[model samples]
Target: MPDNQNPNYEIKTIVEIFKQENLTIPEYQRPYKWTVKNTNQLIDDILLHQEKSKYRLGTMVVHNNNGELEIVDGQQRFITILLIAKVLSDSNFLDKDISYFLTHLKFSNTISHKNIARNYQAVISRASDIVNEKFAKFFSERCEMVQIILKSESEAFQFFDSQNARGKDLEPHDLLKAFHLREMNDSDSSEKIAVVSQWENIKSEDLAELFALYLYPIRQWSKRQSARYFSKSDIDIFKGINLKKSPAYPYAQILRMLESFTQHYKNSPDRLFDNQEVNFPFQLSQTMIDGRHFFDMVSYYQNSKNKLFNRLKENEQTNRIISTLDNQEYKYRTGDKYVRRLFDSAVFCYWDKFGLIEIEKAVKVIFLWAYQIRLTQQSVFIESIDNHARKDLMLFNKIYEATHPKEITQLLVNFKIESKAKNSESVINLAKEFQGIKNEK
Candidate 1:
């Protein structure tokens, strides 16, 4: 273990790595989640790389816990590699080291155990003709990686922090999911499954945009800050108290008490007659509930944001003024798109804090505030929209500060048409609509 004897890292073939002492999947590691399709993709990637002299699979971070090497990242691919080895070793197509790896390696999360079996079958089904002795040898030797051996577990996360900064493939949601999973050290398998299943069902890209477009901006603007981007550094705003592990501070205690009450209400037989549901009180800027509740909150907001915005055409459920805003007369203006998002975000902030009470009025107020910029400016930019949302209208702040919906709905928005603006006739008609809104009680 002396510095003079070993380099900080090493580049090795998958075959060579198998010959070394096995890497440990610490008990804290989350379940193996790579799907059968993912396993098939790995097989295809290996076959594609067979023609090359060597292909770098990617970097892996391993903590040197005294002498034991524990996997810190890349566990998805790590487990996939083991499943591949198990397949190759089964047919006697691979060498002794791979066979030894199969016999010696063990990781026992229940979800992982189930996935390992499913993916093992998937590898055989996908690779039967493709993974012959030549492909197996190529995968073992020509596929390569660099294993980073840091002295402590925190170093592993630090390494990922730097990697994300450099814009590597480490996804922010994935990193946060794994971090919160580690916090759920005492969670039973079913509880973990309940949380993981919902998350795995949503596409990662959708998750990213949900945070960026809706969740992240609302939190920052509610606090009266500019939130143009939601990067890895900004994720602490989303990560919240772990009830069991976080200190019993007053805020944590309130969240925990609410968590307990909500669970009890949902499970109680008295609530069954109405077939009703209870939603956790979610505010745009409240402290998150950490593990299971964190996952549930994300799922809730993700669904809520999609309600009227994602459709190509309107329905009864769709907010009609949204359709009005999109009417062809003025929708083609390039800046109108930014105005639409600004309007929706403000309304969503109010709706989150105060519910659908006078939401129709709230929408119109937000709409008049939003599109007023479009009517006056020859061209609108995102910075201008950011200004309007954060400070110009103080729209988000009003909602953030209000204890009741009346404070927002009862406000008057006054505006005038700029006749010189492009699309004068459409702008005049749109300006006229604000008159009716002002006349409403």
Candidate 2:
């Protein structure tokens, strides 16, 4: 390959550069990701420049030796800049200092900074056969291909990375979003609308964070099971799918799922402060599991004439128990069969039979007790999840004892809190009382 040091390089305008063909990203490269906030910030930066006496022109480095011009860096800024240029395309601003500032800037990077730059320089130097002919049209006036004579592809890449590091960072989600958007560009407007719908209003940065957290599992699963790594591209696609599917959340098995969601929302309060975003404060309630009373309740519900407990137990077993790791644990758990049967025996009395939502809450309550039993084996006060689980356990037994005539009335002979039907309400019900929504509007 010829050396890339002696090619014509200059700065150009948004109208002068064309995206011609997209440079391929390597397997090791991170994804293109940006949140709404980041996108907004870029726009704001351009607007800020326009407000000043002179417009700020960002550097767009291009290697034009090949049939197709490759963009080694500045993809996000380039796009954002394009958006600004488009907005101001016909305005007087186009010929003003702002436009002049944007159009006449040159960007240069040498391979000395990094090995990749050397490779990039080489590719540019021998672009005649290095790049595909089909994408050559993209290097036209639209992108203002300010051809930079670099030594090699490595040189170009190092410049790209360094230049980008000095400005805004590219994220996996932004790239994914860009890819999807570009892929959909050729489709009908209606179809394109659907694609855009998938690109929610999350800031590009927040989107990246969310993608990192959620895609971790899928990434691991893919790598471990397939013995192949997943690209940010793969993760980006999977994230769209996950957003669509609304994957079931088993709070007990993976509290991280719940916690991650909360953490992101908390971190970006600007986005989440509104009632629509996160109205309900997430709480993990803890309840006490009176071993004897619980076992007895299980037995009574299993054999009760009313058959309330059996139905609840059955629901719990089929819905919750089998879904847990312990159920599959080779160490302790036996068969889910007996558990399901026993759970079935409790269904009639369990709150779930009354309503699905209520049942979900009830499962949490029961799980709190089970979690306590697990923790009791380890230590008191289950420190991992705050005191939520412990509190739930205490409340469950409290409510159970209060509701059960003989149990609470007799047990309370020596206890402090009185157990009575009126007093044995679920915490949720008590919360309603506290909210004072007694008489609905």
Candidate 3:
């Protein structure tokens, strides 16, 4: 084996890469899942940039295993280019010998090959005039790619993963994965492989959506603010685990907290464990740099019954109330936006305290406060509900430090009482009625 510590790299045209080495897709690689839309866009990009002195496609990561170059990344683009060459050859656009040699290039026997072939035909049919000798020459000779030849397959994959995360095309969570993976350089190879495998098991689109819809909102709400879209910078909050300079290391702190909880419960007669409620959420903590905890929390909320109202397992009444609110029939008439906002706020508050014990009362009071705001406010847009939820969340955070559920209820009650005094007669009446139900209970 050569000294792969400093691998060779070069800028090569499509024709040069093809002529200089034999390229093959490794079996572990994902099948060419690029759609017709993707191929069409690539074609359009190439055509638009064809007039430039040199059009750079992108970087390709490859490993030389006994002189055979295995493509570790950029297979999709490479295969697409090959299909273009084949299309031109079939059209008799290239010199006979050049066309014949192009035909000999092999592709992996995957479903993607068939799909790519279909897409090629569709592309050629749509833009037959573009698939000429001149365009073929431009694609082969003028278009350039950065060919990165790594020392080993692992290095090639590491390069591919790191570059993909930093690249413009990645989702925010993908960037997080890349950042954490970079930090784990000192970890054993098996540990790193396990992390990557587990991370990949959850699809990128699903992970991104999880952050956007739930985790981001909950984190913001915990600070008593309206939720915004998750961006690149916010990834730092989930980071800092491996950094030594940080005063509060999340990984160590979380492990200590779990240890304390276990010790506290060991002597208790009332102790019981529920997989859905507790065990599953803690399972992710077993791993270092566990972003899995955040994901697990989101999953718990998504799967729980009466998610908004029922925080504690014993709170049947709160569960019933939330179930009623979540009913499609009720939501259809009342609009889901108000209910969703209230649910999110309640969840955030519960999560901040790190347990559902005595959470039902807090959630009940918070829900009523949110309901009153919706009923009293004019022109109740989604934004208005979100603002109210954020305000409530802020108040919750302030009193959360006091370590008592009554403080939360009292704060919400005080806010409601103040708002009720300044509002219209109808609003006052509604508040009185809601109070009557609470008092009676």
CA-only RMSD, every prediction: 5.6, 21.4, 8.4
* Model 3 lDDT tens row, 1-441: 356487688999877866764676654345566788888888889899888889998888889877878787788888877677667766776442344334554444455667877887767875565677678788888899998899766577567666776668767776666455545545565565455545555556767766665556655555565655577656655553442323565557766567457556654555554322223333211333333333334345444423443444346856655555555543543334554555555555554454566665666666566666645454455566567656744654454454666667565453343332222333344345547634233
Ranking by lDDT: 1, 3, 2
lDDT (C-alpha, whole model) for all candidates: 0.75, 0.35, 0.60
lDDT of 3: 0.60
TM-score of candidate 3 on Cα atoms, chains taken together:
0.59
Model 2 vs. true fold: TM: 0.28
Error of 1 at 311 (Å): 12
> In TM-score terms, which candidate is top?
1
The residue pairs in collision within model 3 are: 224-394
Clashes of each: 0, 78, 1
Tens digit of lDDT per residue, candidate 2, span 1-441?
244455456666444443333332221222234344555554445434442433434555554435544454554455444434433433333322234433433222121123233323433343343133222222222234344545454456545544444454455444444333333323464544333433433344445533342223222322222212234435333322121123554533243344467557757858655644532122112111121212222223223323433344467543443244233231233222222222222222233123233554544434333333332232222132223222433332243223333321222111122222221223223323333436345
Decide which is better by lDDT, 2 or 3. Answer: 3
